[model samples]
Target: MNKTNRKKFYDSQTWKSCRKLVLKRDNYLCQLSIKQNKLTPADIVHHIEHFEDNPSRALDMDNLLSVCSSCHNKEHPEKGRKKDKRRMKSRRMMI
Candidate 1:
């Protein structure tokens, strides 16, 4: 899907619901971080297969994983987006 369509899909209620379900399934913990034995909270529902490359599986539970933003960045460094220092802290973050 194109960037516009991808954004629209991500912004949809369906995606939001799916994301919540995945996070719940993963216990809101970062699945990637768990691989490293860390205990970070996940705030994103990431596609195991790139959503753009596998749009057909975008909403498939088996295709999703709960991930922290840092892990998500490592998974897709090609995006090259910088972390915004001014972003609000998550309530779930222990600090």
Candidate 2:
């Protein structure tokens, strides 16, 4: 889907309700945090199968994971790492 359509889907009641259900199912705790024996509150419901790759599974509970921002970034680091690399290169140039 295009950006507008994707945004509309995310803003829809269906997605909101599903997001809440996923968060509740995960007990509002980050699954990654729980695995590491932490108790961080989740702020994102991530798509395990990636919505971009499988839009049909976007609202699938089984394909969702409650996660904190840190865990979410770690899970999807392509954008984050590229930005970080750019920043590092810029810093090196400055130095």
Q: Which pairs of residues collide in model 1?
A: none
lDDT of 1 at 75: 89
Model 1 gets an lDDT of 0.90
Pairs in clash, predicted candidate 2? none
Give one digit per residue, the lDDT tens place, for model 1 in 1-95: 88899999989999999999999999999999999999999988899999989899999999999999999988887764444332334433646
Which candidate's TM-score is highest? 2
TM-scores of the models, in the order given: 0.81, 0.89
In model 1, what is the error at residue 90, expressed in angstroms? Answer: 31
Local accuracy by lDDT, each model: 0.90, 0.95
| lDDT (Cα, 0-100) at 95 in candidate 1 | 61
